[model samples]
Target: MLAFVLLMAVVGIATPQQFWPSLSFVGNSLADIAPFLLLSIAIAAGVKATGADQLIGAAFRANAGKAVMVAALVGALSPFCSCGVVPLIAALLAAGVPLGPVMAFWLASPVIDPEMMLVTAGVLGVEFTVAKTLSAIVIGAVGGYATVAIQKAGGFSDPLRGIEVSTCGTSAITKPAKPHWKFWDDKDRMKDFVGEFRRTGWFLLKWLSIAFLLEGLMTNNLPMDNIGQTLAGLGLWSIPAAAFVGVPAYLNGYAAIPLADTLMQMGLSKGAALSFMVGGGITCIPAMVAVKAMTRLPVFLTYVAIALTGSVAVGLLYALWGGVIG
Candidate 1:
């Protein structure tokens, strides 16, 4: 998409008004989202470096079902994005954790986390954030339970049956090892966190830049009236339509929310916009590829089904409630 946008600019196919807004919009969007993105990536790196992943994995090995439920809750509280959470989920699953709860954590982590909620509040207002968070919790719980039920009904067992738990022994011995003053000290930790921040901060900036350029081209070059007219009569179907449109695109909650807000103001239904955002988070190609890499085909399909169903349901529900509220 970024490449296509750039090509149009070079060929003089794009007007000056369109080209300039595209550039400025990209810059502005990146600037707006920089803080949340940095914070989220830093927290993820810090938690991993501090052995939280190992500790969490040990807990999962102790009681698979209960551990997954707890993981879902913890995922909701953590400030990681969909991409960031993938590594943690992969680490847990690789450590002999059950697939059911791992699926739940992956589904819920992006939409329910604190950073996403904060971004939602900033972009769509507090009401939207509350609604999104509540919806994510419900979806995550349902996904978790459904995964367990499917596993039981199918008499399925894990394929990675013999993998040893990575974190099992990390927390078993409670002796606190003194950190080397070179790397584990407070100053070093801060430097490490800042380094992580710069890395993820750059990543966020790159994507937001691309998104803004796309948004600008769409806004300035596309025929607004025609586009609006085509989408106007969608009504309830708009939510699902938006889901289809968003699923293939890769945008986290932070980047998607502001675009969603803009769409809503342009006569797009709130439910549809929200569905697009959620679906984008859950069903992007990168997310699916990551899941497939770690799990079998059945598990991967189940995960995709849960995300699609949950996104569509939430979108429709939001539309119904929003109608009443208005």
Candidate 2:
């Protein structure tokens, strides 16, 4: 299904004149994202091999609120890209971590990291950096709580798509089994490790291939300068507009800081700028692809909705009183 979908997307987007370059974009992107992909695969495989899910289950189930808060806070500070964060998410899900905290980490991890924050401070301002960091944490917390609330009413019963969750569910969290740190001693564990490594690696590469291909095509076709200017002129609508526009138009987080600065210099509203950064961080095509690859349809849709709405709310609030916080 993934292959057929990717093939269809390629055929639809890559015209004859653009086919080779689009392929090149996918190739280059794969190479560029290789470190994160390899690391993610290794982490997932290691967790499976060593039965570390036991530890993970214990950590998350202790106090749901604490787990969500810690996840949101760590996600903001840790420097993981959309692709780099997947293994942790998968591991958490497999360990039966509640969707709330998993979603918190998923939304926040790609938004702001220490390196990105410092670069943002340098490029934009210390004020902008601080505000964005707060935004990441706040958005994460809100999304997490919302998921928790909805799921309590029976919304996200099965949150996973590819990776299987714990059959023990809440029960596993209550009584986590002891893990075998030296998994190599067991032949079954060794085979599971190898199998997981290969499975996760291939899955990531394929999804990312399609994402990069779409990114390349979009990059070539979209009038980004015009889009930036449009964001500048939308006045009261600018915040929500930024939220929507940011999904497809956002550059990489590192690359985006300078661009955000440039857009602000060109009269982009502060609210719109903040909205674009936060919204884009959550819903950029690659991030969305990473998310979609892991979660079921209902969970994925809710994630997008919550992210965009939270970004818009944050942008509007910042516009009112960012100076006090920043």
Candidate 3:
């Protein structure tokens, strides 16, 4: 809020005539996505307040050959954003949860949460929404199972940095308590709900504002349109190129949707757009920082490799399939 206000003031003073248009662009963009935004916030708050989110842990069951597959699905379905999933990842790894399921969750959790999925569908259409969701699942599964294979080959001998890997056994990260559906019945839970609502709402509002503002600027006169066309003109290389760019883009899941829309309008191919969104979501700065902090350099590097490769592969396959056309 303070940041947005400062932005408004700076724009207002620097170019008084441009002030209304900038603010109005952001305002109208917000209005257009208001329903999905509200639903996203409400559901996230509700899950947090009631502790329903903990259910995702069940996907990482011990001795289950299908754990990786289930984990990938659970990760895609869970509402936890990339940054939000980090603490749980840390907890799961420290609790001796195998690297495979954790890797699956880490890669998939951020790509498309409930909020991201809804907004993506709203902004980019059903095809994009489906592509992004499948991207998450496929990446998570491939990364997860691949890690398991490597671990079996004596790789990732020491995955964590400072975190102590406890002996494999039952723990809280593996088994969560039942959710309190009627959270209001408990004052503490009610407080949790309110706090989560405010925090999530504010966090999303700030990012969305920045995203829409950037979109407005690009739509107005940003020279990036030519850049987009050039990238699109690159043919198949455009997919990997977008995936690489997404690694450093650092845009938030929700924030990236409008940007993707704008870029598509500027001539980005559908596959390249998906690659950008998927790759960016996985390697967003916050999540990368968290991964670096919690894991050793090899693990961090491996994580990046998996994300980039998976994103490119997803883009390539989507392109080959004609991106929802065939």
Among these predicted structures, which one has the highest lDDT? 2
Stretches > 4 Å off in candidate 2: 1-14, 167-175, 322-326
lDDT of each: 0.64, 0.82, 0.76
Candidate 1 stretches with Cα past 4 Å from truth are 1-55, 159-229
What ordering of candidates by lDDT runs from best to worst?
A: 2, 3, 1
- Residue 222 Cα positional deviation in candidate 2, in Å, after optimal superposition: 1.0
- Model 1, position 292: C-alpha lDDT score: 61
Instruction: Report residue 260 deviation for candidate 2 (angstroms).
Output: 1.4
lDDT (Cα, tens digit) per residue for candidate 2, span 115-186 = 888888888888778889999999898889889889889888877886777645455346656788888899
Reference-based TM-score of each model: 0.65, 0.92, 0.67
Count clashes in each candidate, considering only residues at least 3 apart in sequence or on different chains: 0, 0, 0
Error of 2 at 92 (Å): 1.2
Q: Name the weakest run of 10 consecutive residues (lDDT summed) in model 3.
A: 56-65
Q: Model 2: C-alpha RMSD to truth?
A: 2.5
Task: Kindly indicate the candidate among 2 and 3 with the higher lDDT.
Answer: 2
Candidate 3 achieves a global lDDT of 0.76
Query: Which tens-of-lDDT digit does each residue in 20-92 have in candidate 1?
Result: 5566656675566456555556555565445455555555655667756776777677776565565455446
